[model samples]
Target chain A: PSSGIEKPTVKRFESYKRDSQLPQAIGELRILVDYRAQSIILPIFGRPVPFHISTLKNASKNDEGNFVYLRLNFVSPGQIGGKKDELPFEDPNAQFIRSFTFRSSNNSRMSQVFKDIQDMKKAATKRETERKEFAD
Target chain B: MAAKTVQYDNIYLNLSEKPGKLRIAPSGLGWKSPSLAEPFTLPISEIRRFCWSRFARGYELKIILKSKDPVSLDGFSQEDLDDLINVIKQNFDMGIEQKEFSIKGWNWGEANFLGSELVFDVNSRPAFEIPISAVTNTNLSGKNEVALEFSTTDDKQIPSAQVDELVEMRLYVPGTTAKEDAADGEE
Candidate 1:
């Protein structure tokens, strides 16, 4: 245990970046928000996909204020698909950052939902710290 | 026979409890909200937990999924909420554990119920999820927030992600949606 190296603190957000294109059909899709659950339920074709609120980096209304866009960043593997820098969508540890835009005719309903999420974001961070303290 | 349907209008938008039918049958439960392009359905087996609480305006029916976050629907009379609970109990084996709670003004910030796990996130800290079973007890102080006590003897860890897949199911509460629409009109 004599030879040791200290671990790094404060991970840089840029290192988590990964490239992936959103499908064309994503524009029409609706993401279900379980406000109490603090997760975004993505309505894929066959079934819905639920991602934790922690995975989301930022969420806001798109330009023209008619839609809501979300930025989700999650870690993935470093090497996949025989490519060094690309995220293969199947990488479990790759930091995939994808932005999703949802269009709704009723802008206000969408805005309120987004607002609720904004509030939830602050609350989620608080919970995270509490657990970290307990874990330590 | 056709499924029994309960339709309500101007329910909370968050609950997806629009002026549509909440159809409950032997197969499962489904709701068609005005905002959604299509109806969502959930099979009986996937439900993990359920809770009913009285909000400022009316009753809220919260349904937690085994693989997804919990959802709540508002805009129900107490009698109808009771009836819906009875119908679900009599027909389906939802595998849900019920709890008595009333969320007073978002005190604990959004606590996400994912199956047996509960996740909460606050400022400047990482989010974490712990199993509900691991939680020994919960106390509600006068400050309008819940204090959960967990046993550290077992060293339980929080899950980083949720399980796969979600069955389509929809519900809505009219309370918040109406206010949001009014705000839009004023602006």
Candidate 2:
């Protein structure tokens, strides 16, 4: 009962090698989507934490009253609707940051960040699909 | 002669919205911000330790106090490290420990409870840390999943209206029966 297709291996991605390489805009204490680094820098308690594009599942933005909220979902185990094998993790048992929810008053910037994350996700998925096709 | 006070400008104290002037002297550390009417000061006797690290803004000087929450001053340039170290050494007779942060950006890591902080380490280097005091609530959302809600309302240092704030974080911790059994038997 073995299918001919093989599961795709998880590819490792890095955001930055050194601290100096981080974008200067991170000092503003806002979310920054660095396309060149293929990462999103988020300010958590004044510390800039980086999340690589590969770890992201999706991003969304919504408005509530005067503030805009941005939620970022990450690939983790025990999700309901997705193929478990499709999303590979470097270590399935290790602790994972499942998601992050940040709110800001900057509505327009939040929308732009949402769109940027969507575009990055789309591009990454397309590249992944092309790689799989070539491998086959 | 009294120890000369070393001043660094454009430093953000406790992640404040605006930068301030930070002065370190024999008396201790004092930070004055134009936005706030009252200046913050820390006495040398209250100082427990100093940790220097490279943060998103710039260099960060984290001062761990005896019985209070640690104070973080960010936006120091790399060149400021030597002067800051020398000043602390001569005045406070303490050394600044240089801490390196992981830039690999991997989500999976070992979460260790170090003193009052929950440190997440990736490849043996710290990715980020969260103070246990900041956690307002914790719930077991699902199997092997725990969610932590942070206190956003009570923080007087950083204005909530001016910055994007992290409200909650979910962590996936695998279960281990052996450790659980040992804890139960000991109790």
Candidate 3:
């Protein structure tokens, strides 16, 4: 199971063939919700700029192939909002996270639960279109 | 814009560096673990303040949470912390089931690299502290990501942010000539 997480293909755009009109100035991003191969493409739910997440340097899996590790940098979408709550971290929005991934490149583990990493690119494109008309 | 949600693997505080403070991110290697559903990242786009200092033991991480609304989720009471932990753990479980990282774009992580750190920040106090008692290097930077291992309260030497806002969208579409490039590559 040393092949924990599958080797990542070139971490590039969601398949330009699907949408060949993207500009380089940067408009939207692809978010691949990959849970052991199953991936889903989530369109940014809010804001002109949909919240974007992507893999940074690389993803490493454990020797047992039961775990996958990768460094991903997140870009928070909007401005500062809300007051401090009675929690350890004052920002109420700080801990009220709605979604994220716990990835393991573990190969021994078969069958991921998410839809498919291929859809991540689609999610980004959808955001670009939505942002053209919305903000949150 | 709609409400944004993210997730993390660990929730920790910096004892020796910033005094009284805590941060929540994921436990996976690389910065991607903390990304949200459409997947939000812990980018330092809007963040203005950050620090990583050395102390008697390992290091200290400090970041300020933005206060925009009337109620902030920073510094919880003992009960709140417990509740928070439970909630996060539950979120973790729920995420595993959904296999979407986070259902609503949020993720949670608990410190797992071993070592120890005592957090010392109450309600709204500025300086917070943790019990990171491992001797180590402590630096700060925006471009650098946290180490790619199961970090304990000790093995940390990276810059922290009061808050970092990464761009919501990375503009995924390729240039107009993208198809040509792909086609070329395939050929």
TM-score of chain B of each: 0.47, 0.88, 0.19
Better of 1 and 3 by TM-score: 1
**Candidate 3 local lDDT, B1-187, one digit each (tens):** 2222333333222211222222333321112122222322233332223223221122222332232101112122223334333433442221101100122122221122211321212122111122232213222212221211112222334222211111111111112221111111111
Q: Tell me the lDDT of model 3 at A22.
A: 21
* Candidate whose lDDT is highest: 2
Error of 2 at A30 (Å): 0.6
Predicted model with the maximum TM-score: 2
How good is model 2 by TM-score?
0.90
Candidate 2 lDDT over residue span B1-187, tens digit each:
2367888889988877778899998899999987777888999998889999987578899987776677888889989999887888889888999999888877888877665677789889988877778889888887787888987744485453237888888877787421211111111
Tens-digit lDDT string for candidate 1 (A1-136)? 2246533233212111111112222122355565545656553221123455655545656534543333332322221233342222322321122333344445665676677677777787787677556745
lDDT of 3 at B2: 23
The TM-score obtained by model 3 is 0.22
Give the lDDT ranking, best first: 2, 1, 3
Candidate 1 lDDT by residue in tens digits, B1-187 = 2335455554442323134456667766676655566776778787665666543225556666666545545555667765676666766633334333321111112334544454333221212334455456654421222334443322212211111111211111112221111111111
Better of 2 and 3 by DockQ: 2
Q: Which ranking of candidates, highest TM-score first?
A: 2, 1, 3
Ten consecutive residues with minimal summed lDDT in candidate 2 chain B? Answer: B178-187
DockQ of 2: 0.67
- DockQ of all candidate complexes: 0.02, 0.67, 0.02
lDDT (C-alpha) at residue B48 in model 2: 85
Q: Which regions of candidate 3 are displaced past 4 Å? A: A1-67, A76-105, A108-121, A130-136, B1-187
* Residue B20 Cα positional deviation in candidate 1, in Å, after optimal superposition: 3.3
Native contacts matched by each model:
0.00, 0.80, 0.02
